[model samples]
Target: MKYLETYRLTNLPAKAYYIPDFISDAEEHFLLQKITNAPLSKWTVLSNRRLQAWPTQLLKGSVLPTTDALPTWLDDPLVQRMVSLDIWRQSPHDRANHCLINEYEPGQGIMPHEDGDVYHPVVATVSLQDGIVLDIYRKTEDGKREIVYRIYQEPKSLLITTEDMYTDYLHGIQDIDVDKSLYRDTVANWDFLSDDTKQRIELSGGDLKRKRARVSLTFRDVKKVRNLAAFLQMK
Candidate 1:
């Protein structure tokens, strides 16, 4: 696939790719099953969303103790496709070593924040189940922030953020049951969405109602790692 031509979000920042239908419905179903079937303890409950970190969460944001790879269910075709795209080729490890699975029920969204410095400055997010609008903000010199753009992420779509988009902007989803003002002018990737999605938004008179749960699989390469012995010794 000519990725540049097929999935480009040109108006936003230096780099952000929105690939609709990146995964098949069957694949999405399988992934949801795997996520839901995982042992309950694997999920770390946050105030707004619950998450499961693969290969374990970083130790102090700078160390990974396990050499074990991501589970086959998570890695197989998806990771392989991501690797083929070569988005992470320049990253330290040349591939993502971690996956953060976050589940957000309707009306639950994360606060506006950057991904921070724990990982390579690139993120590949796969949305499942439902779609939501991710608001991007710019911090002003006076310390206030303003919503500069919004991207609607659809189910089974791949949203890749890199370079300026990943490093310079704060991205988050609003905790609203309905997303208003959705139209060609308000949505950054409006031109790239599927016709059906666009029609639904238009039919609602530019307001998109939110329903169903949404899950995001965020893949990144953590910059730190340590063997188990070294990790234990530090403790």
Candidate 2:
């Protein structure tokens, strides 16, 4: 409880907390293996990235129709630990009901977007394999998006965004291999980053070049859920 405050991104807008080394190397390996070993049909491959949604994808109405619990691999330690941090205290289920695994290769990224209203206004993202810079933007009157903040998420880190930051702003990553000009004044979470991470970036001439593949486990709670089997039987 008290340790969470130490990892808060105080300089950022509304609420965003970054915790480095949130998972151990063994846990990271275990999660990655589980994701890789899942059924091939479980993956939803896009042009830039591939995603795996636990239980199942949402129905046409943006509702979780399966009503099944997340697999054991996603339950213990990770989700359990997240609750201990007090991030999901106000969520509808008081815990995460949905998990989205997004895998990104170097030079690939998702477009800036909001999580929308289907779920609660909170996101717990766990980064694995590589570090990346997440850019937050505010929409301008001229229909252009202006970068407001940049968060550097290291591997095995947990980043939480809630309240205004989750609902008001747009967040996305750049399609580049290296995040350049990473200085204390530019990166919002610089002050909260571990000294080892800072030095590694500095050693690279103020840039963080993504290495290997990276996957993120984004945990959220879907407000609406239905029983697909029951609905089908009734139909």
Candidate 3:
């Protein structure tokens, strides 16, 4: 994470970085186009959101089926830039092998949850189209969850979470149409956000409304990969 020290969120638990405008507008447009052109079957429509898993989904919830690599549209620029940061140097694969594309509508969000053990602890997410507030929580000894931190993710921004931030905390987006109280104290990465975004929130009286859909591309290294072709041949 040394390459990302400049963008590190010091207010957070331990190792989380937020980079504003991580991708150029052209690159963001290209990614959105590719996602839109994907086959309808590629999208898994859930109750709250829709998802697309690149190189196909995992096998039995843990092992990545090595039938194909990440497509060019999904690999270049984004993952290549992450490689330059050397964030995955210590991971098992030394690079991300899978990506989860999630599209969330206004007032739609997932529950607080840990990513589990299927992938490495390092997770990098790029937000597109809109901004949202991600609430972080910790579980007490009594098994109750409490919010500890909040992260405001802007469109075209890159957010990397690892170490204690990844292992010791649970994260989720609240199911709401507007994010309120967005200020220096509430958002962990407040200092890193663009001035325009800050002004927008301030002028709105600390409330930022969600007016459009937001798409997130989450990249991670799957720890296990099994040969799908070999398994099919055996059967």
TM-score of 3: 0.96
Q: How many steric overlaps does candidate 3 have?
A: 0
CA lDDT scores, all candidates in order: 0.89, 0.89, 0.91
Cα displacement (Å) at residue 91, model 1: 0.7
- Look at candidate 1 and give me any clashing residue pairs: none
Q: What does candidate 3's lDDT look like per residue over 1-235, in tens digits?
A: 3368899888887899998999989999999999989999999999999999998888777878877789988789889899899899999989999999999999999899999889899999999999999899999889999999999999999999999988999999988999989888888988988999999999998999999999999999999887888766756
Query: Candidate 2: deviation at residue 107, Å?
Result: 0.5
Alpha-carbon lDDT of model 2? 0.89
Model 1's alpha-carbon lDDT is 0.89
* Cα RMSD for candidates in order: 1.2, 1.7, 1.7
| Candidates sorted by lDDT, best first | 3, 2, 1
What lDDT score is found at residue 99 in candidate 1? 94
lDDT of 1 by residue, 104-205 (tens): 898889999999888899899999999999999999999988999999999999999999998899998888889899989899999989999999999999
lDDT of 2 by residue, 1-235 (tens): 3578788798987799998889999999999899999999999999999999997787764778755888889989899999998888898889998999999999999899999999888899999998889999999999999998999999899999999999889999888899889998999999878899999988998888888778999999999877887666756
**CA displacement after TM-score superposition, residue 32 of candidate 3 (Å):** 0.7
Clashing pairs in 2: none
Off by over 4 Å in 3: 229-235
